[model samples]
Target chain A: MKKRLLYFCKSFKINFDELEIYDKDFIFGVLGVLVEYLSGLLMMFFIYDFVEDINGWSLDQVLFFYGLNLVGYSLWSCFFINTITLPYYIQRGEFDRFLVRPESPLFQIMMDSFDDDSWGELVTGLIILCYSWIRLRIPPIYFLALPIIVVSGCLIYLGISIILSTFSFFTIAQADVANITMEVKEFAKYPLTIYPKVLQIIFTVVFPIGIVAFIPGMVLFRQIPWQLLLVIPLVAIVFFVLSTRVWYLGLKHYGGTGT
Target chain B: MGNEIITVNRLSKQYHVRIITEGNIIKRIFSKKKYKEIDALNDVSFSIQEGQYVGVIGNNGAGKSTLIKLLTGILYPTAGQVSVMGRDPFNDRIKNNRNIGVVFGQKTQLKWDLSPLESYDLLKTIYGIDDETYKENIKKFVGLFEMEDFINNPVRSLSLGQRMKCEIAAAFLHNPSIVFLDEPTIGLDVFSKDSILRFLRSIKEESNVTLILTTHDLEEMNSICDRLIIIDKGRIIEEDTIEHFTERFTCSKSIVFCIEGDIWKDINPIDNEVLIVDNGKVIVSNVRKERVNEIISLMLANNTINDVQIIEPNFTEMVKKRINEGD
Candidate 1:
């Protein structure tokens, strides 16, 4: 584990240097993150003013859920925005260089940038999360649940991205597939209870975005019978392992050269 | 340098494809189709010495790149064994990679958004080179490649020739004992090609770096390579020293002259093929270069010679003739 940590650190250092190479690219990345945060907050405000509460939950509870998703998306974007462009890189044959390196390509792509744009969302997410926690007057045990939720959310998002990007190995037109995956993931922005029960079940079992947002909210709202926060880490680990397996399966089918 | 840095025994690779179709919505959902397998590499075998500059010459789709990919561990061989530097290239790649430097002419390994210097530094970190040693090597390569003017420029902005030089430099950054260059001089101007080839030759002479070069330009083979292998349809048709290959396969030498009389046609020399005839002009082919003087004497005996020229077959023409002969 220590050796793996050391390797990850070195790889991250390389990625940081790559990030610093383009000053304008860094600026644009930061701008993107900030814009995403502000727009999310604005949408949350409008929804709160009109709906008052969602599914018998108060405004603070919905804001807590929104903040949870914000934290989730921010963390995911922070680690993997660069990886989203992987299909383009694959088409240009640039990804071959990454594949030949000793380190795993997934790690290299994941750590490719610091993602300054996600910082805006991250800061706002923490503030909203803290504010809603105060308004709800949740106990300290739920505070312990926050990190679990965030980690699981990142895994779910990353898993989806990997499955979508893997389509590049087989498809000549994968842009539409990428769009549809992200668009469907956007459905998880709302509370799962607000969705149909079948979709709620589907999201819980198949996609598991609820592990990041809804289940954590259930623990805070005291809606579930037991403390469900413990399940977050298990889901994160399982989903991450499966995503990595699928990624390797896709790579095995990749023909390394041009058509 | 010994005679085997790379050894291959019956290497082959095959790829399978599943056919999918778009019919009516229901049929598209339910239909299953046949699958096909494409054999990209056949049971091929070869070996290279440690310091020999070997060139692989073949037409396109001859599995040249596939062979390189298999040997470099970028792709797995379906059957047979390929050992580079005494390690199985596919199974134990990282250890094997430590001793080999590879350059793909069509692709680059450098960080796309980084400057050449930054990418080189990053490689220095990954390769675990001491800072002082890395600095010395970087200085040497920068000077050799004339990359000082653009070392700070992002790789995306450099010209093709400059980027090619950087790619070559990146491949050698770790100082590997074996260097594989696949069409390293393709699409470069004469000046750039000359510099790269000169640097490669110097590396061979100064260090015991084995070079495996693949290019369609046999002139590249003639100038830098001592050994040659010619492949067609995933099989090596010819392999020998450059001199022997030239002697056995090169078909003709040409002689040109301006006769004093206007006897353009029907001038015969002993055991020579008349290839060109024009007003006050005559040309003969298939004569040995050693018989140039004799042919000149015969031409002068027939008519006063205004001028004389002798031409030996160049490497490209010889390779073209070999291909035609093989066909």
Candidate 2:
């Protein structure tokens, strides 16, 4: 595992260093992340101005949920946004480079790119999370658990991305299709209780997009026991492993049976 | 011969494809899936010795790329087996990949924004190459390929030939034993093709790396490859030493008889191809080697001939024509 991590680091370093060559585009990309974050926060503020809360949670609590979404998505975009390009690669038979390499193709694809935009999102997320934490007078020690919770959330997003990207092998899907589930993530930004019961069930049991932040957020908001946080991370880990299996099977379909 | 670097035993690859004959857009959208199985590659068996340079020649859709993919572990064989250095390439992909290299035509593997030098550094880390050997190989490649001028320039800024030189160098940076080059010279200019082929030949002479290249450039094959494998319609029709294949293919020459006057219909029917008139010359193609003298003597006795010529078939055209004929 150490060797594999080293390979990831090395692969990532090359792509990361490309930022220096095109620093202007990198700056604009960072600004794009900020633009996206500010727009989301503004929309949340607009909604909260009309009422105190949608379903028991206050504006500050919703802000926390939004911050968690940004943090998790930012981490995922940093390493795994390149997955959106897979459909085109599969359609053109350009994925050969990944398999011919000595390391895992999944690892290679994720590390082959570094989205500079994610750095801006990460910074903004921590700031909002800290601001909300102080306003709500949550215990300072809870900050210690923030990183783990955010990482778990990131893995869940990564898992979904992998599963969606694998569909390209059979369907010859485009980038829009590969990221189809991401539309649900927009709904996930708010508290899950705000939605209808059917959607809540779908978010929790079917797609599990809510497990990324809402289930864990329950403990942070003091609505659930601290022990529940442990189970959230385990769900992310198990889901990620299962998603990888689906990805490999899709690869077999591509190379073994068809182009 | 040295040890067998790659051995493919009756390997085959089959795929199921859907055929939608619906001409109407709505019908096509709602049409049921109708699948037909195709044998992309079938019962192919061959072996390559260490340090040998082999060329796979074939027309488009002749399964050349499929065979290369199987050997490189990009595709799994449906039947039979393939062993690269005693390891099944598909089942042991990572292990086999560590010992081999591949180059696909018209695809630049270098990072677009990074200089070739920086890309090499990343490859060093990926392959876990020791510092000394990496440095030694880098210096040698730079010097031999004359990449010092653009080694520090970004890959996007370099010419196709310069980029290809770097790409090939990157593939060999780790000193892999077997390198599979799939039409590495495609879309290159004449000078670029010449330069790339020259570098490949020079590299093969210095190292014991087994090079298996698939290309339509017969002149390149004639100059660099020691052996040739001709694949046609999912099967290898011919495999032999370059010298023998040339001799065998050229044995049946095209005999042209330049008559003083027109005698287009004077020749009697023969078991071989009948005489035909082209620009006032009577020619009989596909004439056997031994029967050349006998037929020419008979024709001379029958008609007045000003000149007689035996033209050996062109290697490149003959290969394509033969494969297309088989198709």
Candidate 3:
């Protein structure tokens, strides 16, 4: 694992010292990250200014949920956006190169491009979380638990992206499927308590978006319900394994059209 | 002389694809019925002994690319099997893949934004090549390809030939024993093409590395490949030693001679079989290699020969004529 991590770092960390800031991908990366960060901040400000609290919780709790979502979502965009665009690569015959590499094609595809836009959202989300915790005078343990939530949330999101991207093999037209995935993800941006009990049950047990965001938020607030925290890693692992299996089966059908 | 390093047996590939046609909105809505199955490769089979140089030639969509893809393990065979170096190409182990290098003319493996040196360093780390070996190979290729002028330049800034040279260099950085070059010299200028061909020939001779080249450039095959496999319409039309194939296909020699007298009207060189005839010059009919001396003696005795030019079958013409005949 240590060797694999080092290999990943070597492939991803190109010498930026020689790169101009005006380079198109670099500029686009910055713009993309900034837009997401600012949007999350704006949404936080709106929610805090309007209602004093939502769903039996203070504005600070809501901000915590928002921050948690952004942290996960931003990290997903940072490394895993390639999964969302698998259809385009397949149609254009670019995915064959990934298949030929020694590493897992999913790994290569997930790390193909890092979205700089996610950095802004990640920084802003952290700052908002800290400010809210300081304002609410929450215990230092909440701060200690923050990294755990973010890490688990990021893994869960990564697993979701892989599962969605794997659909491109079966569904020849996959852009609409990706949009549907985004819509499902957007529903989890808020606390689950605000939705109907049926949706809350489905989101918590069936699809588990609530487990990634709201449950982690609840854990931070010391509303720790049962041994659900242990399930986070398990969920991420199960989804990741299943998606990888599907990706492998799909690769068997990969007839690389020559250019 | 040695065991076959690569073996392909009765390989085939089939694909189901949908291509929607432009039409009225109503037709588009209800007529979602446009799917077709294409058999890209049909029961193609061959084997390559270790360190052998082979050239695969065919027209567009004749299954050359399909065969290469199947061999490299990028595409699965609908039937039969392919084994390279005694292991399946699609095996998920890095160890199995480290022995092979592949370069596609249409795709570049180098990072577009990074300098060639930086890309090389990154690849070295990923492939876990030690510092000494990496530096030694980089220095060697840099000298051979005259890449010093642009090694530090970003790949996107380099000319096409320079970039292609870099791609080839990067593939060999790992010192793979076998290399698959698909149309490597395509679109290169004459000088670049000559340099690349020389580099390839030297690599094969010096290192005894196996090379499988696929291209439409018959000149490349004639100069570099000892064995040739011609594919037509998803089937192997012919596979033989390049020498044997050329000799078999090219049975006649064409000689054009400028004569002093009006040879067109005076001499009936085998009836009206003469391909070209003018006022005082004549282009003789194709004579078999066995009858070359007889035709030349007859021509010399009948007329005053000013200048004569002998044309044999060129590789390009032979391939085109063979493909046309097969079709």
Q: Candidate 2: deviation at residue B260, Å?
A: 21
lDDT of 3 by residue, B1-327 (tens): 377999989987777667777998898878867877788888888998888889999989888888888887877677888888888786543555677778888878887888899888767766677888898989888878999999999899998899889988887888887788889888989888877887787787778688899988897888998889889889998888888888876676688878886643344456334567766666766666666676777778877889888889799988888778783
TM-scores, each model vs. reference: 0.83, 0.87, 0.88
DockQ (0 to 1) for model 2 = 0.51
Give per-residue CA lDDT, model 1, range B113-222, as digits (tens): 77888778666655666778788888988888888999999899999899999999888888887888999989999999998988898788888888889997778679
Q: Who is ahead in TM-score, 1 or 3?
A: 3
**iRMSD for every model:** 3.9, 1.8, 3.1
- Model 1 regions lying over 4 Å from their true place: A1-52, A112-116, A139-145, A175-181, A223-228, A255-259, B14-39, B250-285, B288-310
Give the candidates in order of DockQ, highest first: 2, 3, 1
Comparing 1 and 3 on DockQ, the stronger one: 3
Interface RMSD of 1: 3.9
Superior candidate under lDDT, 1 versus 2: 2
- Ten-residue segment with the worst summed lDDT in candidate 3 chain A? A14-23
**Interface RMSD, Å, model 2:** 1.8
User: Which candidate wins on lDDT?
Assistant: 2
Give me the runs in candidate 3 sitting further than 4 Å from their true place: A15-19, A23-50, A142-144, A173-176, A179-185, A220-222, A225-227, A255-259, B19-23, B32-34, B91-96, B256-285, B293-309
lDDT of 3 by residue, A34-143 (tens): 67667866876787688776778787777777667777777776666667777887777677766655666777676566655566667766777777778767678655
lDDT (CA) per prediction:
0.76, 0.82, 0.75
Q: Give me candidate 1's TM-score against the actual structure.
A: 0.83
**What is the Å distance of residue A47 in model 2 from its true position?**
3.5
Worst 10 residues of 2 chain B by lDDT: B264-273
